[model samples]
Structures are given as C-alpha cells and as structure tokens.
Target: MKLPNPFRKREYQILTPATKVDDSILERPEFLPEEEVKRSGKKTAAKQKKGKQLEGLISYLRKPRAEEGYTVLIAACIAILFTVFAFFGMIQAAGEPSLTVSAAVMSAMLVSAYGIYLAVRALRDKEKDQLYTWVGLSLSSLVMVTWVIALLLGLTT
Candidate 1:
C-alpha cells in the first residue's frame, strides 16, 4: 500500500521557518518612549483657559407699552354708548318722523361698520390679546347691529 501524504493530513502545523524579526519593525521608536507619553498625559491647554466678560457700564432701551386690553374695552364701550345715544336720538326724532330718520339710520350704520372692522382686524391676527379683542369687537358689532335694526323697524326706541 502507498504511504498517505503528510500535507493532506487534518491537523494544525507551523508553515514558516522560525526567523529573528527586525527590532525597528517589531518595537516602538526611541523618541516615542512610553515614559514620555505617560508623563505628558491627555490634558489640553485650551480647556483650562477662561473666557472674557463685559467690562464697562451698559444701558438697555425698551419700547413703549401698548394697552391692547384697555383699547379693546374702550372701543367696545364707545360703540355701546353710541348705540344707546342713537336709540334715544331716534326716539326723540320720531316726532319729526321723516326728517331725522335717515340721519339716525346712517349714524347707526356707520357705528356698526366700525365695530365690524375692529372685529375683523382682531380675528385676522392670531395673538392671544388680539383674540380677546376680536371677541369683544364681534360682540359689540352684534349688539350695535341688533339695536340699529330694531330702531329702523320701530320695534325699540
């Protein structure tokens, strides 16, 4: 029988012949010694530095405050007062009948238009204060419209 080939055997084996490696390839250079690296550590100088602060006196300017709520309240109140006045004026004008009726109607329409304009402006802007403004304006407009219509129909004064 023929002998089995050693290369074909299923077993671990060393392929290369043993030889001495060059010291330069196998070891770190002399300049990059472990002692010097350990002594230097990993600390950075930039991280240890402090930032600058403002030195001289400074003045800050602010804008004037707006009384949006007060404005809205005043507007609504004015519309209401005007409506009341118009109602009374119409009642007094009733004696003259045809003479002052058109004038009273025109005044009422104007007030109602102003209120509607305010309400529309407030509704278009999404700010919280403006939202409240719009609501107040809308309510005032509705009141004025209702009273004006009633007056024209001769239902109320």
Candidate 2:
C-alpha cells in the first residue's frame, strides 16, 4: 500500500552542454509542453542594446544592407567631429574662428548631400521604412536650407 504526499515533487534535472538528453523518452505523454520544448523568446543583453542603438539612427540598415545607413552614420560622425573641431578652433582664436564661414558652409553642404542620398535610396527601395528615410532627409535638407539662407543673407561669404 502506498500513501500520496502533497509536498512531494518530481526530481529536478539540470542540463549542461555535456549533459545527454534522451530524445525518445521525451516523447512520453507525461511531460508538459515546456518540458518537451525549450523556449526561443529569450534575447541577449547585447542584442537588446544593439536594437536600441539602431532605432532612431539606423534601424533599416540591417534589412537592405545598403550604403544609406553607412553614409548617414559617417556624416553624423563627421558632424560630431566638426563640432569638436569648431569648439577648439573658437577657443584658440579667442572667439574669432580660424576656419572661414564659407569653409564651414561647404562642409555642411557636402554632409547634407549624404542625407539626401539616403532619403532617395530609401524612397526608391520601396521595400524599406519610408518615414525614417523622410525624417533623415528633412534633417539634412534643413541644414542645406539654413546654409543657403545664410549665404543669401550674406551671413557667410
């Protein structure tokens, strides 16, 4: 005769890389779905961070694997560098810029071209996220527009 105990639990098995699991025995009807099959929904911390980093700046870069994201990313990198350079140049010059306004305008225009290029690529692809492309385009267009306006107003010769 056997008596049932409410507190009794099945033995726990820990699986490691070296552990051998029996495939045939796993087909038995006693196991739960979770026990029979592992889960795939888990994500690594690195992948989560990468996805966050790509969200606003270059989410579509993974899909087409095109040059648009690369170019835009490069331009953004250069812009950050230019900002640092401009800051130091201004400090060295005691508020008067060592680089002429015209030189700055030219660099801005060149970088702005990359933005337009990315936008056009996004639009023409017809298979990518269009809104992100347009947003990126507008940012570059604004830069070019501001430069043009500055040139027209004689703010930068």
Q: In TM-score terms, which candidate is top?
A: 2
Model 2 stretches with alpha carbons more than 4 Å out: 1-67, 73-97, 155-157
Candidate 1, which segments miss by more than 4 Å at Cα? 1-73, 93-105, 151-157
**Could you tell me the TM-score of candidate 2?**
0.43
Residues 1-157, candidate 2, lDDT per residue (tens digit)? 9898888996566763443433445443334374333443223433576688878794445555444655665564554454456446657778566556436657767777777776677577766545556656776777767666756886545
What C-alpha RMSD separates each model from the true structure?
18.6, 15.3
Candidate 2 clash pair list: none
RMSD of 2: 15.3
Task: Determine which window of 10 residues in candidate 2 has minimal summed lDDT.
Answer: 37-46
Instruction: Please name the candidate that would achieve the greatest lDDT relative to the true structure.
Output: 2
Q: Write the per-residue lDDT of candidate 1 for residues 1-93, one digit (tens) a residue.
A: 988888886765588645554234333333456665456541222223212223343434443222353455466666566666656766786
**Cα miss at 122, model 1 (Å)?**
2.0
Colliding residue pairs in candidate 1 = none
